[model samples]
Target: MIVLDYPYVSRFLTDSVLELGQAVLDTPQARRLAGDAPLHYIDEIEFSARLALGGKVYTNSENGLGHVLRCRCNEDLARQIDICKDKALFRESVAALHPDYRFRRVPFEDLAGLDAPDVDYPFIIKPTRGFFSLGVHVVNTPADWPAAVRAIEAERAALNAEYPEAVVSGGEFIIEQSIDGEEYAIDVYFDAEGNPVITNILHHTFLSADDVSDRLYYTSARIIETWLLPFTDYLRDVARECGFRDFVSHIEVRVTETGDIIPIEANPLRLAGWCVADITALAWGFNPYECYFKELRPDWDAILTENQGMATAMVIGDLPSSLDRTRIRDVDYEGFQSLFANILELRKIDYHQYPVFAFAFVSLPETELPALKQTVSQDFTRFVVTE
Candidate 1:
């Protein structure tokens, strides 16, 4: 029941868990138990060894020390680490055990084999272990492949030079056959028994036109679904195959021209960034943060049984100019806050720290798509960040 919190997303998770009435251990105490806390109240080795030997489950042990501890407690933690570390291996193992389940791995170099004559242009390339869209590229044509490869190589080289210890050795990037369909994301939570109990779906829209190339983009709107019959079966099969019994998964899927469902990629972790939490609250009327904390909460039957008229949009603010910086300080925060009061649910004001990244969520009674576009364009100018 101990929870370690960090950043807004972690705070949201911790708060949600607490709201569910779960007794969570504080970070300091948890660290102390794990033998990393600065306090001298406990013997580090004895405490951690006892905790592991006593069958206390530790979460988020992906760090260096965590890896070492897991290795030491191999008898208890080996299955979890092996299942979590290598997804392709897990898929293969599952497919072997369950012949009915279909699993395929198209290597980074084998994408051209899947290409059909009608398989349109603009495919995406990505690394198997990539996150947050890093090492992702879109190839518009066969001619673009070499240049894209060169760019990726250059970036990798730079990263290696700067932080050689941080770079993974001998990593390969996968070139996926792009599915030219609308993008949607599903956030699924599995129980200890490996059942996909709670699921949420969101429609993701890319901010930059270039970002839509082949992979790596954010969603503009989300629709959470509690009872998803069609998708739940496939998701459960995947979860069981992967040996992921208790964790959140982010699944990317696309609807093809023929209305077939094609799964693009899956992340065996929480949704990156803030949109998942935001959309869950706005669209589902439940905070995922809160739900995640509730121990053995009843599985949702069918909350978002169908897609509602509600829509979500993200505004990617442009970089401010020197002139705008001079005037940004003069703007009235209270006035601008009131001006855009009706349309805004979340406003991230510090764009400079992150650089050219700000997002807003809007919910309207009617789907005034054109009016929504205009509102964002006009309102963005009001909060110019001046230096």
Candidate 2:
């Protein structure tokens, strides 16, 4: 039995093992939709999650206490790091493992002024409990500090109106010295015994240093080819150090040129947003969601032995524009495909909470990245949206 949170389920991914006769989906929405035979009903979200995920299950939480408590059928340990959800708290965990880690917290209202006078430049300031990169600022210099603060404040104001319940509204954000090197996003599931089973390791291609928007943010599974061993080892050590077991984490880290591992943060929740989480399926033959439910550990040696070609996932939206929610009303499907190729799967939908023209791209290396990125730019440019 798998517990599915109604709110987290996506519309594009449906018809999965859970939706089929493979596994039972337990959720409030599923129960409600079942009507007279509530036990037999399934949630619409499970399908969208499947369509995007290519049939993976959404299970596990980093620190989802409410979710763990809601249904007795769910995993209770998912909330092992409830306090760790806050960036400051998680930083403590990371710092404990690595003494070189550095971070501090400042009130959201003081972000512009940054009450800490000695705080150096070229740092990152983000909500203690933030998601989707909202209110995230990278201050490169003293001059950039004011603008960063203003940008964060403006974003906080907008979020106050739109996402009032966000943890950012709680008043504090964390600051940390920016680590130098390649940034990678790792999606993994820990078995009951605390062994981490990695689903995917993505190499992040950002638009710019200060671009907080997820738009133009691209991650390719191709990275798994070179640095998988080192990253997997790092995450395993992090999980053990943080005392995480029976959970899933989507952690971001910086791999220095010399191979030093620095964790940015681990949002110990499921991986990715929308169907982006499912990109693991394209990277590997199995679905990441299924890994959690089935408690499957990736047999890297065997899987890699059989797999051919590489998969890349790219996110294109109104990035490099504004953090303000961009409402998309129209999408040029044909036009979008015309620009890019090797498109394994693409799902364009209105992410109500984020409110932007967001789509997940699972592409094969049949086409070069430069050509693919050019098409992605055109798709985002022409995609109709209320910016």
Off by over 4 Å in 1: 1-11, 20-121, 157-170, 207-210, 213-227, 293-308, 312-344, 347-356, 369-387
Candidate 1 TM-score, C-alpha based: 0.63
lDDT of each: 0.47, 0.59
Global Cα lDDT for candidate 1: 0.47
Query: Residue by residue across 1-387, what tens digits does model 1's lDDT show?
Result: 222322123334444444544333334534443343322233435445544653233232122223224336434344544443344454454554344334344454444444522224566765554434545677788777677766666655433321122122115554445666667777666767778755356665553545542212222223334225656776777766666665655666676677556666655445434333455665555665444434244244444344355555444443432233423454344444443334445454444332233444555543565565455444345556456
TM-score of each: 0.63, 0.79
Query: Which candidate number has the best TM-score?
Result: 2
The TM-score, computed over Cα atoms with residue i paired to residue i, of candidate 2 is: 0.79
> For model 2, how does the per-residue alpha-carbon lDDT over 37-153 read when each residue is reduced to its tens digit?
423334445533442333333343222234333332323343443544677877776676678666787887676555433556678888887766766778787776777776776
State the weakest 10-residue window (summed lDDT) of model 2. 56-65
